[model samples]
Target: MADNDVSQLSASQQQALEQFTAVTAQETKDAIPLLRRSQWNVELAIAKLFDGEAADPVVEAAERAAAPAAARPQIPPPSPLPTPGPSLGAGSRNRVTISPAPRIVPQPTAVSRRPSLLISLLLFPFSLVWRLSNSFASLFYTLFPFLARFRTATSPPSRTQTTRRSQNPRDTAARFIRLFEEEYGTDTGLEFFEGGYAQALDLAKNELRFLLVVLQSDEHDDTASFNRETLINPEVVEFIKTQNIILWAGSVQDSEAYQVSAGLGCTKFPFAALISRAPSSTSNSQGMSVVSRIVGPTPPQTLVLKLTTAITTHSEALERIRATRAVHEAGRAILEQQNSAYELSLARDREITRARREAAERRAREEEFARAKAEEKVLLAKNRIAWRQWRATTIPKEEPVGKDTARVSIRLRNGKRVTRRFNGGASMEEVYAFVECLEYLDESATDEETPERPGGYAHEYGFKLVSPMPRQVYELRSEKDGSERTVKDCLWPTASLVVEVDDGEDNEEGEDN
Candidate 1:
């Protein structure tokens, strides 16, 4: 056997010994199947050596290399091979049989996929409920037009465009101004005023125009908030009252604020409110052109809906007002009815009082007429007595002091003076009075002959002029032509020229001075 190269043991005998020990108790003791298989290879080789087969170093060496190693089994990572096919051979056989491992088609993991089905099932119920509820709600709301016919309609809703947030106040203000200008119109004339709001308010005050402060006052960003000091001042109110100016109040958010602003004072689209196209008016047939507010420009159909809605709202409000008025009238009528009964009871007393008043008025009028007639008779008699007295006491009786210039007067045209004569018995007639002129025998009484009066003559009587009130010679003139007149003696105050015709020039030949 030693001479048989010691390595070449007969394969048939070695196979029989390995098969016997492979099922042995030693291989089974405290070992997993793979471990037992590994130790058995060494155990079988040793048995063969002891059983009269000399150790073949080549076989031993080959067994050491070929046998499975006692090492930690590791889980193989997923293969990158594109397909599952025969990759490695199990044994050295010329005719190879490959048992290809089954391909595991990758599926979605349980973590991501399992919850989706449950969630979908849960949401299905909710969606079903929502759809059902929505349909019912819509159906119910649909009948509101009929149910709420008496209720006032509201303005069609509009949404403000979302503007980008900006830190710059000027940028915000400019954007706001642009929006207003666009919504209203291209502001021409007084449209695009970049002046300060507070300054404009102050300027408006000077012109007797009041400003409406429409804003949330807590916000310092609004100009109206800055005018708080002006708001509470009594003097401001007084000034406003005297100037025929008024302050309007409302929230900026309300449409009434816009309406009120339009009514009072607005720099933009003043003509729009004034020459407003009524909501129902289809064609702007009037020659004046109008543009729609671009804040939320709507098509004609939407605008028509809005118009009808507005009309309905206004009509409702008017109806409410009328209903209130009717209620008030009924109450008043009840009060009047109660009062009428009381009045009916005192009808005889009222008639008696009325008759007494009439009688008293008649008696007073008769007495006044009798007294006036007597006064006229006495005045005429006194005039004749004055004439007799003049005849009796005569200094210039031969020349007749009035005969030298009988009704002397002066006429003025645009302050240029001319002289004439007049005939009557009295001084120059005042502007407010219509009477014949007087031949003044007294030189001191004449305006031109007497120097300019030192005192304000008319105010001494405690009579001030009012509308159509008379000014009684508040000023008098001393002239080179020896004729002068009072301020009131002028034709009109607007024209400051005195034009008394032939009044007193001739009578005042010279002043005593």
Candidate 2:
């Protein structure tokens, strides 16, 4: 009320008071308690000079007027209620309802008072160490392309040292696996091997040993005892080979298999436990690739799943695989050389056959020419004899030729006869030429060059006990089946050489002695 109104007001204004309160506007009239209303009694001055009583009145109603202020009150300006409007289009059987919101869950305490320190630390949201380790590993893999990434991870902070988990191990593994599978998927590239694989095996020259585990299959090759549909397929082998991942077949023996399992941190792997030997530093001749399989307590099929999971979680085992798939380079080289030699030998044989055929043809032509010449010579000799007879009969007088012929006979060794005949030629040139041609005709001239003796000695130096040929001498001879097992070439080791005088002496020599 205004000051003038307050002064003019009756005793009821004496108790009037101003106070703040909260209530539903609809119930504003009745909501204000009678006692509180009584506080607004006697002229019931809301404030300043008032012309009306308002259950909800504004403080501005108390104007600076000393006279009573004009006041009018309707239901308090519709208490700002939310406007109801059409929601979007869809219709549900039930009207769209906004149910009470779920109770807000209190955020987990950063430091839980109930948890042990170790538990809290372990469960700590910070995987920074792991992330960093992973990043560093990924960087290393990228930098060293040939370094086959495997399950590589630092043991979780082994006591004192900070450990790093491969932050992006999956990424690295996936990359390696992709590359490996790509390379190995080819025929004989890196797959289950049989006999031919043995030859291929000879080509590997690596720091580690690669063992192709042959998981058995009962469908076609029933020899395999491992479960069907669970065979260690070529894809797995390719994956291993591409990654330079060692292909190891698990062993049936649990203890022996445990070594592999423990190393892999898994009970199963892609391969079956059907191997001749657990993958080790040793070499194996058995066709382990396709013959052996990965066998475990778990069905063969499940082994792969477990193994994959293990590899995902563990990194050390993967590195071990990389370390083991090694090839034997030296042996492979030797085998290649042998193959080359064999091929060369085959080529040489083909050339030799062609040459022999050509030689035979030449020989046949030469022989035919000689026979015709010989027949012509015989006919000429007969005609000369007939002409001589005719000349003797017709022109008996003039002897006009100075011609002579000489024949000599000599006895030779071996009771053989040697006859020498000289032809009456005008000069020696003709004979000399014939002799030269005869020498050239000798077939022995066509022989290949003789090999020198061992120890760089000439074959002409025959005085030595060891022959220039240096033939392979054996100590004894023993034959088995049809082949000769030995020869007595090294008999000199026990026998002494000496000149004997017991036999083959003439009677005259005996008398002289």
Candidate 3:
């Protein structure tokens, strides 16, 4: 068969064929035929090459005796053969005469079979008894279902049952303590927090206390000694309590405690770590830093000394931080107060400025009113003077002729007297004009030139032509004719007139006119 025909053979058979060809230095074709004849037994194929008809005992003995011993290479013994029966007598064995014929030994089948059958027969009654017992018990359970509860009550609780019963943190901690005490003995005198690692950290942060985390592993050889000597030491306990440190203990068996150990990169059992916030940390984001670590078994004094040293060093820095914070707070408060004062002062100044502006506006209004009143008085006087002058010019003037004239004497308010003569036909307006001329002339005689007159009769003085006898005032107009009357008609021929200082009523009337 071709080399590819070897692919059909099993892996072991193909390996044996290749070995046979390589050892014998024969072609694959030559080795394949021999391998096929030998049923793929490499050892038997080699043996066949040395002695033909190697399967026949007589022929193999004769060849071994005849062939020179040096010419034949020794072959190692073949592996144990399969058990012989009629199955080995098939035709396939006839084609492949590979090794010596296996010896056929008769087996004592009855002798071996009889003992097993007897043993089974002896154990049959016991199996029947067990089945009957099981049936009875099952029937009892079916009849009285409540009896099942008694069986469960008698049985011990499983791990899952106990776990469910103690799911609370405090219960779990109690159980942990109980188990630890049972294993290591009671009265350990070590205080342990009932909460988890996170709760311990939060307590430490809130109280500003150091966190002492003790991770215990039961598998460690020194765990008991460390707990008894270092952890339970009275001095260590007292110091931790006095320093306000929170102590949290956990076992390696707990899932959360195991996780904490892994995170802290703990390699040794009975590991103690001191954790606290960093000195410069202002928020939780900065997190806690491990201040000191004690591993394995440490003496109580040494552990205490290390913890105290860490506290002293970090405490100084913490004090400094608090002092700086206080200073900053004080400065900020002062700045706020200053800003408030400045704002108050600014408000007061604005109020004062507004008041001053209002006062100035009030004064300006009062001054303006006074000036308007004075100007109104001056304008009224000019109007009255112009009316008097027009009246004087319009009245008819009569020159005194012969004895038909009237002589009028007037007494001025200054106690001066003035006498004027008018014809009997002259109007009374002429007499009033003569008195006004006397005022102007007298002012001009004393002063270099009188200031421009406003043209009304001086309101300070008023004149009326009154008769000394009967004390009758001259009428400005005739009652009968409703025309301008002559002075002779009012005073007749001669009369005395008086110029008197007017009272407030006359001055108001003059202004109205």
Candidate 4:
């Protein structure tokens, strides 16, 4: 290319041209056309140069004209024409000749009638035998599953578009590779990936690598040479390995391989394709696309050239996609962390609210219990005062005036002495009550001043009167029983008694002893 024309190209295109000219050792003017034809692919341009497609016919003719005459290739002489033959005699020899008429051939008539009964009966035994044989074969296959493989092997080949059988793609791929290696030998440097075609595509897309699919047809004449020479060539194998391409090859005889070939629109045997992530313009629905196709047999250099061109063109786009994915992943992780923290804070708030509610309820219950207990104590005190006032009124103003009158002298619990006279019919409880109401006995003691007994209350004296001479005790019974011993029963006539507090200490001491 001219210097001015080269400057008009982009930086990448100019670089590609320079590399192309350097490798092919061709003049800039001569290399531009080849590079343009290969879309500025240096590898492809170099391949075209070595194939002699870059030669100029005008220049070749000029070189031939400048050469000496003796060195030129000799031209062979043209062959002589043949002599004319003698004419045949007429008339005297003209005898009459008869022409034969055309014969009509019978045409076949279409049969629209049903088959005869005799024909059906004649074929009945053969049909029956065929059905029996099929039944026996099916039974055998069912009894021994291993025989199914043999039946498959013996089956006739089906149409290429139709799948023969469904099998595990991994197993199919491994088996194909094993058989390939056995036929081509292990030294074939091309490493075929041992997995299904779909799996290979997924791996290549996720890893941002190129996938090279090599589909071989055993019946094709070019298959053997292609595997032997082009695929195993050192330059081709090294290029594929350096590019980190995922190579997956299979025979067209396999169901998966047949389906792949049909899907990729393979019109020739020994087909190979370079597939990678679809470009941004077409990526909405397509994950991958065929970037380059090499059909029939190709030289190692041409195959490498096609692969290199496709990879170099798409590498930039793949890098951009990878960067976008990393940013999205980082943002998603941060969002998840924030959500988990919020959930923990919400749970802690709920727990604190529950504890406060329980504490408030417990305090309310305790306050209610204390208020009820205080009210009960005040009611009991009032009942005791009312009973004392009532008993005081029942005491006589003076000693009974009768010969059966009894006098008693009692010492109160507060160390005070009290003398009282009771009627002969007075009970022992009367003497006890006389001592109890000694302070309440006054001119003001009256029935109107006394209050009713406390509801559900049973009053008992806290002290008992004891006889000093014989140590006999007079204990008051509960008023609810309404029974009391008379004063004459123990303290008739005259008696000296001491009132002592009836605390439970004596009962505790007795139990301890």
10 residues in a row with least lDDT, candidate 1: 94-103
Cα displacement (Å) at residue 368, model 3: 49
For model 4, how does the per-residue alpha-carbon lDDT over 365-479 read when each residue is reduced to its tens digit?
Answer: 8888888777876676667666766677776675655777778888766566777778877667777766666666763364355544446667777677899878888655435
> Whole-model lDDT for model 4 versus the true structure?
0.67
- Candidate 2: Cα lDDT at 70: 44
Q: Write the per-residue lDDT of candidate 3 for residues 1-513, one digit (tens) a residue.
A: 333376777888889877776655767656665675576877667666543434556645765797676764454323322333223344233223211111112122222344487788999999899999989988998899788555533332222222223244455567677776786667666667877677777777655678888877654556778887888788997898798788877765655565566666666666888877554334436356666677767999999987876665455445434444554566688899999999999999999999999999999999989889889877866665654444434434445555878777778655678676787777777776666544344334455533443453444325565666677776567677779988667756778887544455344332211
After superposing candidate 1 on the true structure, give the runs of residues whose Cα lies further than 4 Å from its correct spot. Answer: 1-124, 129-342, 395-513
TM-score of each: 0.15, 0.19, 0.31, 0.45
Predictions ranked by lDDT, top down?
A: 4, 3, 1, 2
Q: What is the lDDT of residue 227 in candidate 1?
A: 31
1 or 3: which has the higher TM-score? 3
Task: Give the TM-score comparing model 1 with the true structure, all chains together.
Answer: 0.15
- Candidate 2 per-residue lDDT, tens place, 85-173, comes to 22223112111211111111112223335878897688676666777887897799779855521321211111111122222223323
Where is model 3 more than 4 Å wrong at Cα?
1-171, 181-189, 280-286, 321-513
- Local accuracy of candidate 1 as per-residue lDDT tens digits, 1-513: 121221443564345334444433323222222222334354443333222234357745665686455532332222221322222341112012111111111122223444477788989989899999978866875776454222212222111211234223233335555654463345221222233233333443334232323222111122232232332334443443553332333222333333333333333211111111122333333211111221122233443333233223223323333444554566689899999998986997899999999999999999999999999766654453344233222223211334333322222223343333322222233321211112333432333533332222221111111222343332233344545554323322222224333333232232111
Best by TM-score: 4
* True-structure lDDT of candidate 1: 0.34
- What would the TM-score be for candidate 4 when compared with the true structure? 0.45
The backbone clash count of each candidate, in order, is: 9, 41, 2, 5
User: Number of the top candidate by lDDT?
Assistant: 4
Candidate 2's displacement at residue 174, Å, is 35
